[model samples]
Target: MFIVFLKFSENKSLASQFMDGHNQWIKQGFDEEVFLLAGSLQPNLGGSIIAHNTTLVELQNRVNEDPFVKESVVTAEVFEISPKKADARLNFLVGA
Candidate 1:
């Protein structure tokens, strides 16, 4: 599994301009079953995504394609996680 943080950058103002494309990128992730969750960061700092079913290099390439990242509206940091255990409902994550 992986956690992707998209923190606002100096060019955060450009966010609105690329929001449509960014949203589309997010939609694509879900459509492909790569993203398990996505939401806003606390205090509006930025956004985050919990993802799986992909390798780190592939995830990095995917993140690079986000309009927010490509246009410098945000900086993306991807953290990989080795899941050893999970709640029963989320046991699928253990193999990620």
Candidate 2:
């Protein structure tokens, strides 16, 4: 699994301009079953995504394609997680 953070950048003001494309990219991630969750950061920091079923390289490439990232509206950082345990409902993540 992975946690992807998209923190606002100096060009944050441009966010509105690319939001539509960014949203479409996010929808595609879910449609492909790679993103398990996506939401805003507190205090309007930016956004985040919990993703799986992909390699770090692939994920990085995907993130790079985000309009927010491409247009410098946000900076993307991806963290890989090796789950040792999880609640029953999330057990798949542990084994994955």
Candidate 3:
């Protein structure tokens, strides 16, 4: 799994201009089953995505194509994690 963090950049003002494209990119991730979850940051300063079903390199490649990255509206950092355990309800995260 991966935790992708998007930090609002100084160019955040340009976000509105690229939102449509960004949303399309997000939809593509979901359609391809690369993203498991996505939502805003606690302070609304940025956002984060929980992704799976993709390799780190592939995820990085995809992120590079994001409108936010292209227009410098946000800076992204990815953290890769290996799921070892999960509660029964979410046990699927730790493959059998």
Candidate 4:
């Protein structure tokens, strides 16, 4: 599994032009069973995502395709994770 941490440079703001594409990517990720959880930090400062069973390369490629990344709205750091347990209430478990 991998955790993708997105830190949008303070200089940039979310772009309306990229919103739709970003939403689409989120949908696609969910459909592909890769994206586990995603949300932004408080006050809309950066974001974080959990992707299941994905390689850093694959995650980077996926992020590269994001309109936010393409437009330089945010930079990302990817980390490998070994989740000992996932909250059932959140539906974050890979296999339920």
Candidate 5:
């Protein structure tokens, strides 16, 4: 699994743009069973997303295409996540 941490920079305001594009991603089919979970950190500092079984290349590509990235509203860091035991309460697992 991969976890993407996005830290918004000063290029542009991220919240509204990000939310619009995020919702569009969900509507588009990226939300089917791959993303796992996504949301922003409180205070709108940045955002984080958990994606299952995806490569770094794929994650980068997705981020590149995201409106926030495309519009230069935020910068991101992608990390490989090793969850010893995923919590079902958070619905981080697909189809949970």
Candidate 6:
């Protein structure tokens, strides 16, 4: 899985300017079952997303297409995690 942070840039205004397109990009990820969860960060700074079904390199390429990244509204920082354990209901997250 991956924990992705969208850190706001100095050109924060671009976020609202391109909000629609950014949302579309996010929808695409969910539609493809790559993103499992997402939400805004504290104090409205930016946002975060939990994703799977892809590799870091592939995720980077996908994030690059986000309007937020394209218009300099935010910079994407991705951290990959290899799950070793999970609750019974989510056991599928960590496979043998």
Model number with the top TM-score: 2
Computed on alpha carbons, the lDDT of every model, listed in order, comes to: 0.96, 0.98, 0.91, 0.77, 0.70, 0.91
* Model 2 Cα lDDT, one tens digit per residue, 17-72: 99999999999999999999999999999999999999999999999999999999
| RMSD to the hidden true structure, all candidates | 0.5, 0.4, 1.3, 3.0, 3.8, 1.2
What candidate 3 gets wrong by more than 4 Å, as runs, is none
- Candidate 1 vs candidate 6: the lDDT winner is 1
Which 10 consecutive positions of candidate 3 have the poorest summed lDDT? 87-96
Clashes of each: 0, 0, 0, 0, 0, 0
**Residue 44 lDDT, candidate 2, scale 0-100:** 96
Q: List the residue pairs that clash in candidate 2.
A: none
Put down candidate 5 lDDT per residue, 11-96, tens digits, no spaces: 65555846787668645525456677778877867777777656678778877777777777778888876666656775454432
- So what's the TM-score on candidate 2? 0.99
Q: Which segments of model 2 are wrong by more than 4 Å?
A: none
On lDDT, the stronger of 1 and 4 is: 1
Q: What is the Cα-based TM-score of model 1?
A: 0.98
Query: Per-residue lDDT of 60-87 in model 6, one digit per residue for the tens?
Result: 9999999999999998899988889899
Colliding residue pairs in candidate 6: none
Candidates sorted on lDDT, descending: 2, 1, 3, 6, 4, 5
Model 4, residue 71: what's the lDDT?
Answer: 82
Q: What is the lDDT of residue 3 in candidate 3?
A: 94
Score residue 20 of candidate 1 by CA lDDT: 98
Clashes of 2: 0
Segments in model 4 whose C-alpha atoms lie over 4 Å from true places = 84-96
Show pairs that collide, candidate 5.
none
- Residue 59, model 6: lDDT of 95
